[model samples]
Target: MFISAKNIFKNYGSTQALSDISFEVNKNELFGFIGPDGAGKTTLFRILTTLLLADKGSATINGWDVVNDFKTIRNNVGYMPGRFSLYQDLSVEENLTFFATIFGTTIEENYDLIRDIYVQIEPFKKRLAGKLSGGMKQKLALSCALIHAPELLVLDEPTTGVDAVSRKEFWEMLRNLRDKGITIIVSTPYMDEASLCDRVALMQNGKIMQIDTPQHIVGEFPRKLYAVRSSNMYSLKDDLLHFPEQHSVHLFGQYLHFTAREREADILGLRHYLEGKNHQNIIIEAIEPGIEDCFIELMTENSASNEN
Candidate 1:
């Protein structure tokens, strides 16, 4: 395993930040840790990168224990934090040079490793890192992280605040990196980006909800689903939630996504119930489940089991 974490636990004051979180990343794979904000993604990343220690369990990168071999782990992994942490006052070229110096290397020594990405922003080498656009800053940060030619790359929500085009470009850059035989372990809140990974671990609160390829996870959605819309959208949601046959009710775009209580749920009865409630222009059509849908279902199941 390129990366391995077992039963890791972390705490912050009274809150349990991570609980028995365990997963492994294979060599040369693009593994994603999918979750929303405050889902303990950053906390787990910190522990894996050796910036923080876990209260319990163990983690290793490239077969070296994170705690005991912090020095070796730090040298072998390239980490791009959630926030841009490069020197704001320094120019892009200067920042890259400084990072290379710290790692006992020079830009010329590892130029080939970052050439593809660096070329995109090379013209702005003299520009201050703080003055560059969000996308450019992202490219520069990645350049510095890869300057030392680390075998593993750990990124924490690298595309969170960037524009849509920039986000797409960033993912393309990641794919290029993966092609270079660098193992990547990234965390993101965006469900759409999950499909791009070789495998993903859906996380919520402080636990791993599920781990599988995006196709497999979506393929395993256990209930029949439908997309519902009505002239009175607000009232329609309320009516569906109150419907005895609704397993779950959630908003998706301009429509409400519903999972039926039973496979044989009465579609006509549901439409009539909405009509009786004065919800005009009613439309309910069966649809396939998405990754977000599966995530919600798993979360709901987990919460209900805990309550019982």
Candidate 2:
């Protein structure tokens, strides 16, 4: 394992941040840690990057213990935090130089490692870090982090708050980086990004719900799903939920996604029931599951199982 975390735990003044969080990343794998805000993603990233120590359990990067070998781990991994932490007063070139110096290296020593990304923003090398656009800033931040040519890159929500175009470009850059054989472990709140990774660990609260390739996760949804839409969507949702054959129902895009209690759910009966309630323009069709659908199903099933 290029990265290994075993039963890690951390707490704030009163609230628990991470609880027995454990996972591993293989060499050169594009592994993603996915969850919503306050899902303990930052806390776990901090622990793995050796900026904070866990209260219990252990973690290692490339066989170097995070706590005992902090210096080595620091030297071997590139980290882009959730927040933009580069020096605002410094120009792009200066920031890159500073990070390289801290790692006892120079840009000339590892120029090839970052050359592809750095060249895109080299024209803005003289611009102050704070003055760059969101996409430019992300590219510069990644350039600085990679100037040291580390084997692993740990990014904590690097795309949050950026525009959609920037987010798309950022993921494209990540795909190129992964092609260069650098192990990457990134955390993101965007469920759509899950499919971009070789594997993902779905997280909620502070625990991991499932770990698998995106296809595998979506392939495991047990029940038949349908995408339902009607002219009176508001009333249609209410009527569908009240039906006795429903396993689950939730809004998805302009349609409602639902699982039927029986595989043989009567669509005609459902449409008639809504029509009797004055709902119109009913459309219900079986739809293939996506990552978001699988994630919701997993969390719902886990919660129900725990209650039982």
Who wins the lDDT comparison?
A: 1
Instruction: List where candidate 2 sits over 4 angstroms from the true fold.
Output: none
Model 1 lDDT, residue 165, Cα: 95
lDDT tens digits, residue span 183-298, model 2: 99999999999999999999987888989999999888897889999898887788889988888898998999988888656888887887888877778899988888988888
How do the predictions measure up, each by TM-score? 0.97, 0.96
Task: Write down the RMSD of candidate 2 (Cα, Å).
Answer: 1.4
lDDT per residue as tens, model 1, 1-308? 88889999999989999999999989999999999998999999999999999999999998999999999999989999999999999999999999999999999999999999999999999999999999898899999999999999999999988899989988988988999999999999999899889999999999999999999998999988899999888888899999988899999999999988796568999988888898888898999888899999999999999999
List residue ranges in candidate 1 displaced over 4 A.
none
In terms of TM-score, how similar is model 1 to the real structure?
0.97
